[model samples]
Target chain A: MNAAYVNVSTPHADRNISGIRLAHNRLKVAVFVFLLAFLVTAARTVELGVRSGAVEQSLALDIVVEPVQYGRADILDRNGEILATSLPSTLLQADRFKVQDPVVAARQLVEILPHLSYEKIHSQLVGKKGYVELARQLTPNQKWAINALGNPAFEFLEDEERIYPHGRLASHVLGFVDVDGKGRRGIEGFLDYRLSQTDQTQDAIRLSLDIRVQYALTYELRAAMNAFQAKGAAGLVMDVNTGEVLAMVSLPDFDPAEIKSTVEGARFNRAAQGVYELGSTFKTFTLANALDQGTIDLTDSFDATKPLRVGRFSIRDDHPKNRILTVPEIYTYSSNIGSAQIALEIGKERQQEFLGSLGLLERPSIELTAVGVPQLPPTWGKAATMTVAYGHGIAVSPLQLSTGIAAMVNGGRLVPATLIHNSEGWQEGKRVIKPSTSRKIRQLMRMVVTKGTGRYANAVGYRVGGKTGTANISVVGGYDRKAKISSFVGVFPMDDPQYVVFALLDQPKGTKKTFGFSGGGWVAAPVVKSVIARTAPLLGVAPKKEDASLYETVSLMIEE
Target chain B: MRRMVTGLAVITAMASGAAVLQLKLAVQDKTDNVRKIVQDIQVDERAIRLLEAELAYQTSPNRLQEQSNRFLALMAPKASQVLADPSSIPERPAGARVDSSIDLTVALEPEVKKPTKKRLYKRKGAQL
Candidate 1:
């Protein structure tokens, strides 16, 4: 019985051991599977954290990159109005290797772009193995027509074209870019480095111009030019205190986009680039300088009884007051004889120094590239001094004259004229004359409008004070007796001077309305008057009742 | 006890791994959304620039002057038409009815005049 029980127990024990071993093997397999899954998951997590980030970063870079290249930034007016801008235009290119037939492609292109020469397009596409630009600056219609052809040989390249929307209104100011997108003239050339930075995200350059004022000035000037049958006209409006040019117009002006068709004379900026002998306007400078130097006073009288004889030159007034005229009378009447005597008193060296101080002897320090260098006499002789006193021997641009006049009236500070809009009301500048001298000069200018040649310049409710300058155009040997440069420089609300509006007409023939007189008072004064009347309200200058005492003071001064 | 600890460790690791995977996916989605938004913003900016240029061209002073000459009765304000002070405005005609709802006196209060220095002058008849 013991042997049989032992056998049974041994068998049971063996079977139990076998079952445990099998269970252990299954557990081992399960543990291996679980470890493998954990390893796989850990590796996937690492890949997502490290490798995927790089992939996503490269994908993001690819999505963000743009192929379009913007050329230059925009040019805006002081009021944030667009003066010049770059527009995205399509350029058509052709691949000769891909072309099925060059004749067909050129024909289709010419139909789309009528302005393009078919011969030129055919020549460019016939033998060009690489890509060749068939036409550039294509209109949207042209681009669509080319696209409709669905030619594999054609490709569209993105490009930028500069456009001026106002068209000849501020042409001299905005200028034009060349075919290579390089700025060629005007503000475009002056500020090329700043404008052509190619930064896609940058603010536009804001000029000091006011477009409304510019339009008003140009309209009045053009109307006057047409009415007077003048050869050309130039006008400028500037802030007296700040030296900011509000408007500058030179006509006949060219459309900036169609520069190739315009004549070279149309491209000349008469307001800034052409130097002329601006006549009696220089009297203001002489008188102001004399008063500042204490060499002459308002009560001092000059001999205008005859043509002032300085050697071979005879300085005679256009409208001669043939008597001993006081300084105020000389300025108001624009007496060239009296002015020559006063300049003789100032002398040549002092006169040169004074004009030099006024920035009249050097190139105008404005932003435009086409500024004219003032033409001075070869020898600063006595005759030269007398002639220059009445504005004959020395030639300066209208811009320089305006600047000098502004300094004489704007509390005696010679502020440099600027085309950039800084938004500051007044600019600090070098003092060229005493404030007392400036006040006396203002009084004299007001006297001109009140009692003298600038009577037509007085706009109603705006105290327009100015001087009229009618200079004869110089010819080969002498001055032309018929053709003249008639100009007026007027400042409005004369009590507190704000703006200088200058109008000039070159070779303006006498109109029937002007009674056969081609003088500054008749031709240019009316232009300044209309400009002040139209733009003063827009410039936010309010109209006030006539100050009785101010007129009384001016009248008393004139009487004295 | 050891077996239980091992099972607990494995479960915790798996759960944390799943959370991390979900977080990464959410981050990627947000990044993609941000990229799309940036692209949309750039597109809108370009559109706005183009529209502004168009508006400027349409309302340029030259064009407006032409349009006004053609179609409008309005003119630029004259110097006499502009007044500095509201009190300086002329009174309404006597027969015109006043608006009862609005009080205009507060807006039309007269400003005090500053004292000015007097000058010696003989007065002329009908002088301004």
Candidate 2:
């Protein structure tokens, strides 16, 4: 407010103003730097928080949702029964560095596990600088006992033990696994990669086999085997409509758990793997072919009064009706001469083609590793054709025979056999013959059961129809007459066929109860009868009341 | 404006750091818990698998057949024994009372406790 304060353009005042301006700019710069630092710090904190949180979340998810890994998946029956599984076990190890006293530990370990040699364990415990595996596949009880010893040096590593709970019941089907958990035979060998795969969660593989039906088949076959003193036996039951195998039994089967110690012969799967001359069962195929090709009618006659000689072969009937036999009578009485004459009429080409269409010449298209290839004759000439007509000179597995019969009787459809359960039911197969021809085949088969060699297979109220076959086992030079293969293949509820049951006995000897007769009619037919009687109710097939009129025309044809 | 902005940035940084620390600790604790729970689940699953295997072994058809032979004496129902149609079963006698609690099945059971033939003969002789 005074004259001196109002002085302008003075040097001192100018200096003071300049210095204040400089200081003010410096203060602004400082504040800006601090703000930038704070912003950078905040951004870094947010980035770190997000990144760490993401990593932790993924870690948690990985641990929480990861699927458990069992060494192998289970094999189940259609009803969800466990046939084979893997049990948890451990491998015993010794940390050599941590072990204070190797001798004492080895002695104690051997005491707990007698199977482990004390010298091997002692050497291993003292041999290495690191860990040493002393034993593999220790049971839980052994692991617990080892833990009780309270030695920090002892380590129980995780392992798995494969077990078959059914023992020898389905040995041929499930097969046995090796010590390293690899499938070695049967279905297990066929589906090895599928069963042991670990990419995703694995579920049990269900088969088409009904365990109850399997038991019934095995029981009856075993009883017959024992009663008739058979050297080997094989049997199977199949769904005629879908071609699904319900049960398969091969006698002298080894337990899958103790497979290493069993005899090699017992390990052979006879039902699906052994090619034998299946005898007169092939007559059904011959007659069915003749009917399908319009070569012969039901009323046509074949001269079966004497042995039919073709080339070097003399074909005769086992149950001979020495007269001119009708088409149905040839099949009913299992006349080899009639079958050969019919085959001659059909010729070699047509007979071979017909059997091929029925899936008899090729190996069975089943899910088994041991499927036997059919041993066909070298040349389809006259003698070969005649013998092949009666199921000689060409050997085939029982499974192939059953399949051929199924096609003949199951409305002429040739469905390939399968062991896997089809959730979608009743797949249609390729038609092989006319439905009329199939009907005639069924009628003839029923006649066999009612009035011919298959009379023993007539289960009460079931109306079983079947054919009998008794073939002498073929040797290096010729057939061994003493060693015969007696077989019977039956279809039940002949009015509407549902299942095909087959039984075969290799070299069965006579018994007192069988009237010293080891023929298919005496030994194998009764087995089929028992199997049908037991399995009909389990299959939910009701017992149908007998309708006599259904067979009246056939009875007239036979009686006339 | 600069001072206010600085104050806000500092507060955000401190708050984010504190929150990150808390989150990390909680995650660490939860991870341990998850691992333990996963281990427990694995143990339970293994036990369940073992028990299922055991049950299957115990109830195998062969074992069951042996058990039936030894103690149960039960037999599979025959085809004739299975009547598919309910109408095929005979009706109760005429004038029979409709008593829901009266178990008619008891009368159908075989007389297991019936006297032996020798005892019956002795009783008849005594009566005579």
Candidate 3:
């Protein structure tokens, strides 16, 4: 009995000990696995921290793509009015292989787009070609109508179309573009690359033109041209201080919208391109040169008892005083002999130097490609000098004449003409003449308007000052007696001039209005007066009272 | 013991892998959503540009001038009419009287007014 009990107890004790050993082994295995996992997680965390910056940079590089390109920029006027702009349009094309019935598609397309020919579209679609253009520049409404047809064969291509909103108002300045979106003429041609740049964040290019002033100048010029039965006309209004062109109207102007319909003569910009021998106007320059050089004084007198004969040509005054006239009297009476005498005193070298300083000897440096080169003489002999003194030998564009006059009046500064608006205030200009000389010329100009040939240009309270020039148009051999280029250059409130207006009529006929006289005073000075009367209020130039001090300041001393 | 340890490691690896896969899918979904929103913004901008151009064309100065001449029959103001100083404008004459009898309220009243009970009673009393 003792042996059997011992056996049972021993086996039970042995099994219990083995079970305890198995549980201890399992705990050890669990700990070992957990420790390995912890070590791996810690290593991975360190690795991620070390390389995180590089990974983020690579991801950013992968995400960002190139920016899309939008076509051309806009051109705005000084008042933020749209001069030229681009609008999006669609072009309709067809895939012939996808078309179920070419006839049905062509018929439906013609219905929506009446301008397109059905037969031409049908031929294109039914031909061997896989693709064909149906219409270009489709309006949004038309595109919607075509899309509603649910034709799988049709596809639309997007494009841009340039438009001028002002029509013929600033045609010569804004210019027009070709069908391929290339600039053809005027400002459009001059600044093509800047206009067609892909970046659209840039602001619209602003021009220096004031539309209201432009309209007024064009309207008056057209009216005067029609009334006088003239061949053509040109007018310009410039800010004397800044050389900013307020208005430039070359009549017989073409509508930039319909460039093909423009006539041959209408495309010529006479204000800057047509060179003419502007008569009596040069006398102002001659007198200014003499005064600037101290070669002649206001009290100096010249003998105009008879027509002065120089070499082969004879110089005579239109309204001869026929006596010894002082410098003021010569300018007021518009005497050629007196001007010739002053020219002789100034000599040839000084005359050329003065004119050269005014930028009259070279091509006008305007923001236009249609500028004309001055017709200067090859030799500055005594005959050329005398003739040029009265504006007979040297021919220049109206733009040059206006610019030179602006320099002489605007405190003797030669400011280059520009079409772009200068937002940073007035540009510093080169001094061409003395301030005193400019002041005296202002007085002479006022004297002409108040007491001389430009008496008709007196716009009541504006203190108008100017010189009238009527030159016979030169033919092949000599001057044409009947055909004349009548022009007037006027400055207002001459004591402190702000604007200079220059106008010219080409081949103006004598009318019964002025007893058959078609000179500058009759034909062009009235145009200047009308323009000033219409545009001064718009330009914010206040009219002086009837008896303003400006009248006394620019008053001339004459020996009547 | 060895089999149990192998089982725990495999389960942990499978769970982490599934979580990472789910996170990647969510990131892709958000990116696609951002791209769609950007595309929609581009379409709206194009439409706005088109409308702006159309508005400019309709309000062009030349067209406005033509319409004014035809419909309004207005003439251009002359220099004499344009007084530079506001003080220069002539005062109204004493003979010109303001007509206080003009009742803009009556003109603006609806023709077919629905009468409330109070309004109808007031009207009956006025008629009587």
Q: Report model 1's chain A TM-score.
A: 0.88
Q: Is candidate 1 or candidate 3 better by DockQ?
A: 1
Native contacts present in each candidate (fraction): 0.57, 0.57, 0.21
Tens digit of per-residue lDDT, candidate 2, span B14-124: 987898799899988988888889888888887888888898889877777766654443555656787878898998889987888979799778777567776555444
TM-score of 3: 0.76
Give per-residue lDDT, candidate 2, residue A346. Answer: 96
TM-score of each: 0.83, 0.83, 0.76
Candidate DockQ values, in order, are 0.29, 0.42, 0.15
lDDT tens readout by residue for model 2, A1-560: 33554476588877866887799999999989987996798787577667765665554646744556787888888788888888878888888999999889999999999988999988888895598988877877988999999999998888888888778887887788987889988888888888888862268889988887888888889989988889999999999988889899999889988877988699799999999999999899999999999998888888889998776657778888889988888888888998988899999989989988888888777888888999998887889999998899899998898888888888999888888998886868989999988988888999999999999999887889999999998899888978899999999888898999999998999888877888898899999998888889888778877787877776677743
Note the Cα lDDT for every prediction shown.
0.85, 0.86, 0.82
Off by over 4 Å in 2: A1-63, A94-107, A117-134, A150-154, B1-36, B90-94, B100-128
Please give, for residues A378-402, the per-residue lDDT of candidate 3 as tens digits: 7889988998998988999888898
lDDT (Cα, 0-100) at B45 in candidate 1? 70
Judged by lDDT relative to the true structure, which candidate is superior, 1 or 3?
Answer: 1
Compared with the true structure, what per-residue lDDT tens digits does model 1 show for residues B78-127? 67677868897788889999788888987699675543322112111111
Model 3 clash number = 0
Q: Assess the local accuracy of residue A239 in candidate 2 as a C-alpha lDDT between 0 and 100.
A: 90
